[model samples]
Target: MNSVRRHALTGFAGLALVYLLLPIAVVILFSFNDPVGRFNYTWAGFTLDHWLNPLAVPGLGEAMRASIEIAFLSSLTATLLGTPIALALVRYAFRGRGTTNLFIFLPLTTPEVVLGASLLTLFLNLGVSTGFWTIVLAHIMFNVSFVVVTVRARLVGFDRHLEEAAMDLGANGWTTFTRVTLPLIAPGILAGALLAFALSIDDFVITLFTAGAQTTFPLWVYGASRIGVPPE
Candidate 1:
Protein backbone atom coordinates (compact mmCIF):
# COMPACT_ATOMS: atom_id res chain seq x y z
CA MET A 1 0.00 0.00 0.00
CA ASN A 2 2.86 2.42 0.86
CA SER A 3 4.66 1.52 -2.38
CA VAL A 4 1.50 2.13 -4.37
CA ARG A 5 0.97 5.53 -2.69
CA ARG A 6 4.59 6.51 -3.36
CA HIS A 7 4.24 5.58 -7.05
CA ALA A 8 0.98 7.57 -7.24
CA LEU A 9 2.64 10.66 -5.74
CA THR A 10 5.60 10.33 -8.10
CA GLY A 11 3.27 10.07 -11.09
CA PHE A 12 1.32 13.09 -9.92
CA ALA A 13 4.51 15.13 -9.51
CA GLY A 14 5.71 14.12 -12.97
CA LEU A 15 2.37 15.06 -14.48
CA ALA A 16 2.42 18.43 -12.73
CA LEU A 17 5.93 19.14 -14.00
CA VAL A 18 4.92 18.32 -17.57
CA TYR A 19 1.79 20.45 -17.28
CA LEU A 20 3.82 23.46 -16.10
CA LEU A 21 6.52 23.00 -18.75
CA LEU A 22 4.26 22.15 -21.73
CA PRO A 23 3.90 25.77 -22.93
CA ILE A 24 7.62 26.42 -22.61
CA ALA A 25 8.38 23.22 -24.52
CA VAL A 26 5.96 24.23 -27.26
CA VAL A 27 7.56 27.69 -27.48
CA ILE A 28 11.04 26.14 -27.78
CA LEU A 29 9.84 23.73 -30.46
CA PHE A 30 8.15 26.53 -32.44
CA SER A 31 11.19 28.78 -32.45
CA PHE A 32 12.71 26.64 -35.19
CA ASN A 33 9.50 26.60 -37.27
CA ASP A 34 9.56 28.42 -40.60
CA PRO A 35 6.08 29.81 -41.06
CA VAL A 36 5.01 30.95 -44.55
CA GLY A 37 2.72 33.63 -43.13
CA ARG A 38 2.85 36.32 -40.43
CA PHE A 39 1.62 33.86 -37.80
CA ASN A 40 4.12 31.33 -36.51
CA TYR A 41 1.52 29.33 -34.56
CA THR A 42 1.31 26.45 -37.01
CA TRP A 43 4.60 24.77 -37.79
CA ALA A 44 5.12 24.98 -41.53
CA GLY A 45 8.68 23.74 -41.69
CA PHE A 46 11.88 23.98 -39.64
CA THR A 47 14.31 26.69 -40.67
CA LEU A 48 17.14 28.75 -39.20
CA ASP A 49 15.84 31.98 -40.77
CA HIS A 50 14.36 33.36 -37.58
CA TRP A 51 17.50 32.55 -35.65
CA LEU A 52 19.72 33.96 -38.37
CA ASN A 53 17.80 37.20 -38.63
CA PRO A 54 16.54 37.90 -35.12
CA LEU A 55 15.85 41.61 -35.74
CA ALA A 56 13.69 41.00 -38.84
CA VAL A 57 10.71 42.36 -36.96
CA PRO A 58 10.63 46.15 -36.66
CA GLY A 59 11.14 47.66 -33.19
CA LEU A 60 11.81 44.24 -31.67
CA GLY A 61 15.47 44.99 -30.99
CA GLU A 62 14.68 48.48 -29.72
CA ALA A 63 12.00 47.17 -27.41
CA MET A 64 14.35 44.51 -26.06
CA ARG A 65 17.07 47.08 -25.46
CA ALA A 66 14.65 49.38 -23.67
CA SER A 67 13.45 46.56 -21.45
CA ILE A 68 16.99 45.53 -20.51
CA GLU A 69 17.98 49.07 -19.74
CA ILE A 70 14.91 49.67 -17.60
CA ALA A 71 15.40 46.41 -15.76
CA PHE A 72 19.06 47.19 -14.97
CA LEU A 73 18.34 50.73 -13.80
CA SER A 74 15.35 49.80 -11.69
CA SER A 75 17.03 46.80 -10.10
CA LEU A 76 20.15 48.76 -9.23
CA THR A 77 18.17 51.64 -7.79
CA ALA A 78 15.90 49.34 -5.79
CA THR A 79 18.83 47.42 -4.32
CA LEU A 80 20.62 50.60 -3.31
CA LEU A 81 17.56 52.14 -1.69
CA GLY A 82 16.36 48.94 -0.09
CA THR A 83 19.65 47.75 1.45
CA PRO A 84 19.77 50.67 3.83
CA ILE A 85 16.13 50.33 4.70
CA ALA A 86 16.57 46.62 5.29
CA LEU A 87 19.52 47.28 7.60
CA ALA A 88 17.51 49.89 9.49
CA LEU A 89 14.54 47.61 9.94
CA VAL A 90 16.67 44.68 11.02
CA ARG A 91 19.24 46.45 13.19
CA TYR A 92 17.30 49.30 14.79
CA ALA A 93 14.13 49.64 16.77
CA PHE A 94 12.49 52.82 15.63
CA ARG A 95 9.06 54.39 16.06
CA GLY A 96 6.62 53.33 13.31
CA ARG A 97 8.80 50.37 12.46
CA GLY A 98 5.70 48.20 12.17
CA THR A 99 4.00 50.79 9.99
CA THR A 100 7.02 50.94 7.74
CA ASN A 101 7.05 47.16 7.41
CA LEU A 102 3.34 47.19 6.59
CA PHE A 103 3.90 49.78 3.88
CA ILE A 104 6.78 47.77 2.46
CA PHE A 105 4.57 44.70 2.18
CA LEU A 106 1.66 46.67 0.74
CA PRO A 107 3.15 46.82 -2.75
CA LEU A 108 3.81 43.09 -2.69
CA THR A 109 0.21 42.35 -1.62
CA THR A 110 -1.51 44.90 -3.87
CA PRO A 111 -2.87 43.64 -7.18
CA GLU A 112 -0.77 44.62 -10.19
CA VAL A 113 -3.74 46.30 -11.88
CA VAL A 114 -4.54 48.39 -8.82
CA LEU A 115 -0.91 49.33 -8.29
CA GLY A 116 -0.51 50.26 -11.95
CA ALA A 117 -3.65 52.38 -11.90
CA SER A 118 -2.59 54.08 -8.68
CA LEU A 119 0.82 54.90 -10.14
CA LEU A 120 -0.77 56.25 -13.29
CA THR A 121 -3.10 58.44 -11.27
CA LEU A 122 -0.24 59.71 -9.12
CA PHE A 123 1.87 60.56 -12.15
CA LEU A 124 -1.01 62.40 -13.84
CA ASN A 125 -1.81 64.37 -10.68
CA LEU A 126 1.84 65.31 -10.28
CA GLY A 127 1.93 66.39 -13.93
CA VAL A 128 4.71 63.91 -14.57
CA SER A 129 4.60 62.81 -18.20
CA THR A 130 4.46 59.05 -18.55
CA GLY A 131 7.40 57.74 -20.52
CA PHE A 132 10.68 55.89 -20.15
CA TRP A 133 11.58 57.46 -16.80
CA THR A 134 8.08 56.91 -15.49
CA ILE A 135 8.23 53.21 -16.34
CA VAL A 136 11.63 52.95 -14.64
CA LEU A 137 10.25 54.73 -11.59
CA ALA A 138 7.24 52.43 -11.51
CA HIS A 139 9.45 49.36 -11.71
CA ILE A 140 11.68 50.74 -8.96
CA MET A 141 8.67 51.35 -6.74
CA PHE A 142 7.47 47.76 -6.98
CA ASN A 143 10.92 46.18 -6.90
CA VAL A 144 12.04 47.99 -3.73
CA SER A 145 9.73 46.00 -1.50
CA PHE A 146 11.09 42.70 -2.77
CA VAL A 147 14.63 43.93 -2.23
CA VAL A 148 13.90 45.02 1.33
CA VAL A 149 12.20 41.74 2.22
CA THR A 150 15.00 39.66 0.75
CA VAL A 151 17.82 41.61 2.41
CA ARG A 152 15.90 41.71 5.70
CA ALA A 153 15.56 37.93 5.64
CA ARG A 154 19.30 37.64 5.06
CA LEU A 155 20.01 39.99 7.97
CA VAL A 156 17.72 38.06 10.29
CA GLY A 157 20.01 35.01 10.16
CA PHE A 158 23.15 37.17 10.40
CA ASP A 159 25.61 36.68 13.25
CA ARG A 160 26.02 39.95 15.11
CA HIS A 161 29.07 38.46 16.84
CA LEU A 162 30.99 38.88 13.59
CA GLU A 163 30.41 42.62 13.61
CA GLU A 164 31.27 42.84 17.30
CA ALA A 165 34.46 40.92 16.69
CA ALA A 166 35.42 43.24 13.85
CA MET A 167 34.80 46.26 16.07
CA ASP A 168 36.80 44.70 18.89
CA LEU A 169 39.69 44.25 16.47
CA GLY A 170 39.74 48.05 15.95
CA ALA A 171 37.76 48.08 12.71
CA ASN A 172 35.37 51.01 12.39
CA GLY A 173 31.65 50.52 11.68
CA TRP A 174 31.96 51.56 8.04
CA THR A 175 34.99 49.34 7.51
CA THR A 176 33.32 46.35 9.18
CA PHE A 177 30.17 46.79 7.14
CA THR A 178 32.04 47.14 3.87
CA ARG A 179 34.44 44.27 4.52
CA VAL A 180 32.45 41.82 6.63
CA THR A 181 28.74 42.58 6.65
CA LEU A 182 28.40 43.51 2.98
CA PRO A 183 30.14 40.34 1.73
CA LEU A 184 27.95 38.07 3.83
CA ILE A 185 24.70 39.68 2.72
CA ALA A 186 25.88 40.02 -0.89
CA PRO A 187 24.05 36.87 -1.96
CA GLY A 188 20.73 38.18 -0.72
CA ILE A 189 21.37 41.53 -2.41
CA LEU A 190 22.20 39.85 -5.71
CA ALA A 191 19.16 37.61 -5.46
CA GLY A 192 16.92 40.59 -4.79
CA ALA A 193 18.43 42.52 -7.69
CA LEU A 194 17.94 39.60 -10.08
CA LEU A 195 14.34 39.16 -8.94
CA ALA A 196 13.70 42.86 -9.48
CA PHE A 197 15.20 42.62 -12.96
CA ALA A 198 12.98 39.67 -13.85
CA LEU A 199 9.88 41.38 -12.55
CA SER A 200 10.66 44.64 -14.37
CA ILE A 201 11.39 42.89 -17.65
CA ASP A 202 8.30 40.67 -17.49
CA ASP A 203 5.90 43.37 -16.28
CA PHE A 204 3.11 44.14 -18.77
CA VAL A 205 0.10 45.65 -17.05
CA ILE A 206 2.08 48.11 -14.98
CA THR A 207 4.33 49.04 -17.90
CA LEU A 208 1.28 49.60 -20.09
CA PHE A 209 -0.19 52.04 -17.58
CA THR A 210 3.03 53.97 -16.96
CA ALA A 211 4.34 53.91 -20.50
CA GLY A 212 2.96 56.66 -22.70
CA ALA A 213 5.02 56.09 -25.85
CA GLN A 214 7.92 54.01 -24.55
CA THR A 215 7.74 50.33 -25.42
CA THR A 216 9.33 47.47 -23.49
CA PHE A 217 9.78 43.89 -24.66
CA PRO A 218 6.55 42.74 -22.98
CA LEU A 219 4.71 45.69 -24.50
CA TRP A 220 6.05 44.78 -27.93
CA VAL A 221 4.97 41.19 -27.48
CA TYR A 222 1.50 42.38 -26.45
CA GLY A 223 1.20 44.57 -29.55
CA ALA A 224 2.43 41.76 -31.79
CA SER A 225 -0.19 39.44 -30.32
CA ARG A 226 -2.92 41.55 -31.95
CA ILE A 227 -1.63 40.61 -35.37
CA GLY A 228 0.16 37.34 -34.68
CA VAL A 229 3.07 36.54 -32.41
CA PRO A 230 6.11 35.48 -34.35
CA PRO A 231 8.02 32.64 -32.76
CA GLU A 232 11.16 34.70 -33.06
Candidate 2:
Protein backbone atom coordinates (compact mmCIF):
# COMPACT_ATOMS: atom_id res chain seq x y z
CA MET A 1 0.00 0.00 0.00
CA ASN A 2 2.86 2.41 0.86
CA SER A 3 4.59 1.65 -2.43
CA VAL A 4 1.31 2.09 -4.28
CA ARG A 5 0.79 5.49 -2.61
CA ARG A 6 4.34 6.54 -3.48
CA HIS A 7 3.82 5.63 -7.12
CA ALA A 8 0.56 7.58 -7.21
CA LEU A 9 2.24 10.62 -5.64
CA THR A 10 5.08 10.50 -8.14
CA GLY A 11 2.62 10.24 -11.03
CA PHE A 12 0.69 13.26 -9.74
CA ALA A 13 3.90 15.31 -9.44
CA GLY A 14 4.87 14.38 -12.98
CA LEU A 15 1.48 15.44 -14.24
CA ALA A 16 1.82 18.75 -12.42
CA LEU A 17 5.16 19.44 -14.09
CA VAL A 18 3.69 18.62 -17.50
CA TYR A 19 0.76 20.93 -16.89
CA LEU A 20 3.05 23.76 -15.84
CA LEU A 21 5.34 23.34 -18.85
CA LEU A 22 2.64 22.69 -21.45
CA PRO A 23 2.24 26.33 -22.44
CA ILE A 24 6.00 26.89 -22.83
CA ALA A 25 6.27 23.71 -24.91
CA VAL A 26 3.40 24.87 -27.09
CA VAL A 27 4.96 28.33 -27.60
CA ILE A 28 8.29 26.74 -28.57
CA LEU A 29 6.53 24.39 -30.96
CA PHE A 30 4.32 27.06 -32.48
CA SER A 31 7.19 29.50 -32.81
CA PHE A 32 8.23 27.27 -35.69
CA ASN A 33 4.74 26.47 -36.93
CA ASP A 34 3.21 27.85 -40.11
CA PRO A 35 1.71 31.35 -39.82
CA VAL A 36 2.96 31.74 -36.26
CA GLY A 37 0.48 33.52 -34.05
CA ARG A 38 -1.79 32.83 -31.08
CA PHE A 39 -4.43 31.64 -33.53
CA ASN A 40 -2.20 29.22 -35.49
CA TYR A 41 -1.99 25.79 -33.85
CA THR A 42 -2.41 23.29 -36.63
CA TRP A 43 1.04 21.75 -36.09
CA ALA A 44 0.62 20.70 -39.73
CA GLY A 45 4.14 21.81 -40.66
CA PHE A 46 7.34 23.33 -39.30
CA THR A 47 9.48 26.28 -40.34
CA LEU A 48 12.09 28.45 -38.68
CA ASP A 49 11.06 31.45 -40.80
CA HIS A 50 9.40 33.20 -37.88
CA TRP A 51 12.71 33.38 -36.07
CA LEU A 52 14.92 34.13 -39.07
CA ASN A 53 12.68 35.78 -41.61
CA PRO A 54 13.55 39.49 -41.85
CA LEU A 55 10.57 41.74 -42.48
CA ALA A 56 8.72 39.10 -40.49
CA VAL A 57 7.02 41.79 -38.43
CA PRO A 58 7.45 45.46 -37.69
CA GLY A 59 9.28 46.48 -34.46
CA LEU A 60 9.89 42.85 -33.45
CA GLY A 61 13.52 42.65 -34.50
CA GLU A 62 14.38 45.99 -32.97
CA ALA A 63 12.54 45.26 -29.74
CA MET A 64 14.16 41.84 -29.44
CA ARG A 65 17.59 43.37 -29.96
CA ALA A 66 16.89 46.01 -27.35
CA SER A 67 15.59 43.44 -24.89
CA ILE A 68 18.69 41.28 -25.26
CA GLU A 69 20.99 44.24 -24.76
CA ILE A 70 19.11 45.41 -21.71
CA ALA A 71 18.95 41.92 -20.22
CA PHE A 72 22.70 41.42 -20.57
CA LEU A 73 23.72 44.76 -19.10
CA SER A 74 21.15 44.85 -16.32
CA SER A 75 21.70 41.27 -15.21
CA LEU A 76 25.46 41.73 -15.29
CA THR A 77 25.23 44.85 -13.15
CA ALA A 78 22.84 43.19 -10.71
CA THR A 79 25.01 40.12 -10.31
CA LEU A 80 28.17 42.13 -9.75
CA LEU A 81 26.43 44.31 -7.17
CA GLY A 82 24.41 41.54 -5.54
CA THR A 83 27.25 39.04 -5.22
CA PRO A 84 29.09 41.29 -2.80
CA ILE A 85 25.96 41.86 -0.76
CA ALA A 86 25.32 38.12 -0.61
CA LEU A 87 28.93 37.43 0.34
CA ALA A 88 28.76 40.02 3.10
CA LEU A 89 25.54 38.57 4.45
CA VAL A 90 26.91 35.05 4.37
CA ARG A 91 30.44 35.70 5.58
CA TYR A 92 30.36 38.65 7.95
CA ALA A 93 28.73 39.69 11.18
CA PHE A 94 27.59 43.26 11.09
CA ARG A 95 25.29 45.72 12.76
CA GLY A 96 21.96 46.21 10.95
CA ARG A 97 22.34 42.86 9.22
CA GLY A 98 18.68 42.15 9.82
CA THR A 99 17.78 45.48 8.30
CA THR A 100 19.91 44.79 5.27
CA ASN A 101 18.33 41.38 4.83
CA LEU A 102 14.89 42.88 5.18
CA PHE A 103 15.67 45.47 2.52
CA ILE A 104 16.92 42.81 0.11
CA PHE A 105 13.91 40.57 0.71
CA LEU A 106 11.49 43.49 0.55
CA PRO A 107 11.66 43.73 -3.22
CA LEU A 108 10.79 40.03 -3.60
CA THR A 109 7.63 40.59 -1.57
CA THR A 110 6.71 43.85 -3.31
CA PRO A 111 4.17 43.77 -6.11
CA GLU A 112 5.53 44.51 -9.58
CA VAL A 113 2.85 47.07 -10.24
CA VAL A 114 3.52 48.87 -7.00
CA LEU A 115 7.26 48.89 -7.52
CA GLY A 116 6.81 50.16 -11.07
CA ALA A 117 4.46 52.90 -10.02
CA SER A 118 6.77 54.01 -7.24
CA LEU A 119 9.79 54.05 -9.52
CA LEU A 120 7.87 55.99 -12.12
CA THR A 121 7.00 58.60 -9.54
CA LEU A 122 10.58 58.89 -8.34
CA PHE A 123 11.90 59.32 -11.85
CA LEU A 124 9.33 61.96 -12.53
CA ASN A 125 10.12 63.79 -9.32
CA LEU A 126 13.83 63.64 -10.02
CA GLY A 127 13.28 64.95 -13.54
CA VAL A 128 15.03 61.93 -14.94
CA SER A 129 13.95 61.38 -18.50
CA THR A 130 13.47 57.70 -19.20
CA GLY A 131 14.83 55.55 -22.01
CA PHE A 132 16.73 52.30 -22.51
CA TRP A 133 19.01 53.06 -19.59
CA THR A 134 16.03 53.71 -17.32
CA ILE A 135 14.64 50.33 -18.22
CA VAL A 136 18.01 48.76 -17.42
CA LEU A 137 18.08 50.54 -14.07
CA ALA A 138 14.60 49.32 -13.23
CA HIS A 139 15.52 45.78 -14.22
CA ILE A 140 18.61 45.91 -12.03
CA MET A 141 16.68 47.25 -9.03
CA PHE A 142 14.09 44.49 -9.15
CA ASN A 143 16.46 41.67 -10.12
CA VAL A 144 19.25 42.38 -7.62
CA SER A 145 17.37 41.05 -4.62
CA PHE A 146 16.80 37.71 -6.35
CA VAL A 147 20.50 37.40 -7.15
CA VAL A 148 21.51 38.18 -3.58
CA VAL A 149 19.17 35.56 -2.19
CA THR A 150 20.22 32.88 -4.64
CA VAL A 151 23.98 33.42 -4.23
CA ARG A 152 23.54 33.45 -0.47
CA ALA A 153 21.92 30.03 -0.63
CA ARG A 154 25.01 28.68 -2.39
CA LEU A 155 27.23 30.41 0.15
CA VAL A 156 25.43 28.80 3.07
CA GLY A 157 26.74 25.32 2.32
CA PHE A 158 30.21 26.50 1.26
CA ASP A 159 33.19 25.67 3.45
CA ARG A 160 35.01 28.75 4.69
CA HIS A 161 38.02 26.63 5.44
CA LEU A 162 39.14 26.91 1.83
CA GLU A 163 39.48 30.64 2.13
CA GLU A 164 41.33 30.29 5.42
CA ALA A 165 43.63 27.70 3.85
CA ALA A 166 44.30 30.04 0.92
CA MET A 167 45.14 32.80 3.36
CA ASP A 168 47.43 30.46 5.31
CA LEU A 169 49.15 29.56 2.04
CA GLY A 170 50.16 33.25 1.59
CA ALA A 171 47.54 34.15 -0.97
CA ASN A 172 46.24 37.68 -0.48
CA GLY A 173 42.55 38.63 -0.22
CA TRP A 174 42.10 39.26 -3.94
CA THR A 175 43.95 36.08 -4.93
CA THR A 176 42.03 33.95 -2.41
CA PHE A 177 38.76 35.36 -3.62
CA THR A 178 39.43 35.20 -7.35
CA ARG A 179 41.22 31.82 -7.37
CA VAL A 180 39.44 29.79 -4.73
CA THR A 181 36.20 31.37 -3.48
CA LEU A 182 35.01 32.72 -6.79
CA PRO A 183 35.50 29.44 -8.63
CA LEU A 184 33.52 27.62 -5.96
CA ILE A 185 30.61 30.08 -6.05
CA ALA A 186 30.81 30.84 -9.76
CA PRO A 187 28.02 28.44 -10.75
CA GLY A 188 25.58 29.97 -8.28
CA ILE A 189 26.38 33.48 -9.52
CA LEU A 190 25.90 32.34 -13.12
CA ALA A 191 22.58 30.69 -12.35
CA GLY A 192 21.36 33.79 -10.56
CA ALA A 193 22.53 36.00 -13.45
CA LEU A 194 20.61 33.83 -15.94
CA LEU A 195 17.51 34.05 -13.80
CA ALA A 196 17.88 37.83 -13.65
CA PHE A 197 18.28 38.02 -17.41
CA ALA A 198 15.13 36.00 -18.00
CA LEU A 199 13.20 38.13 -15.56
CA SER A 200 14.49 41.31 -17.17
CA ILE A 201 13.52 40.16 -20.66
CA ASP A 202 10.10 38.87 -19.59
CA ASP A 203 9.31 41.94 -17.53
CA PHE A 204 6.17 43.79 -18.58
CA VAL A 205 4.47 45.75 -15.84
CA ILE A 206 7.60 47.40 -14.46
CA THR A 207 8.96 48.05 -17.90
CA LEU A 208 5.65 49.53 -18.94
CA PHE A 209 5.69 52.00 -16.09
CA THR A 210 9.40 52.84 -16.21
CA ALA A 211 10.44 52.42 -19.84
CA GLY A 212 9.17 55.87 -20.84
CA ALA A 213 9.74 55.99 -24.61
CA GLN A 214 11.83 52.86 -25.22
CA THR A 215 10.09 49.62 -26.20
CA THR A 216 11.16 46.19 -25.01
CA PHE A 217 10.32 42.84 -26.57
CA PRO A 218 7.42 42.13 -24.24
CA LEU A 219 6.19 45.68 -24.56
CA TRP A 220 6.25 45.32 -28.32
CA VAL A 221 4.40 42.03 -28.10
CA TYR A 222 1.76 43.54 -25.83
CA GLY A 223 1.27 46.43 -28.23
CA ALA A 224 1.24 44.08 -31.21
CA SER A 225 -1.50 42.04 -29.57
CA ARG A 226 -3.77 45.03 -30.13
CA ILE A 227 -3.03 44.55 -33.78
CA GLY A 228 -2.31 40.92 -34.66
CA VAL A 229 1.29 39.62 -34.79
CA PRO A 230 1.93 39.81 -38.55
CA PRO A 231 3.02 36.78 -40.58
CA GLU A 232 6.53 36.84 -41.96
Best of the candidates, TM-score: 1
How many Å off is the CA of 122 in candidate 1? 1.2
RMSD of each: 1.8, 2.9
Q: Please, what are the lDDT tens digits per residue for candidate 1 over residues 139-221? A: 99999999999999999999999999999999999999999999999999999999999999999999999999999999999
- Cα distance off (Å), candidate 1, residue 126: 1.5
lDDT of each: 0.95, 0.89
Candidate 2's clash total is: 0
Poorly placed runs, candidate 1 (over 4 Å): 1-13
TM-scores of the models, in the given order?
0.93, 0.87
Q: Residue 100, candidate 1: how far off, in angstroms?
A: 0.8
- lDDT per residue for candidate 2 within 22-124, as digits (tens), equals 9888777767777644555466577777777744576877899999999999999999999999999998999999999999999899999999999999999
Best lDDT among the predictions, by candidate number: 1
- Candidate 2, residue 72: lDDT: 96
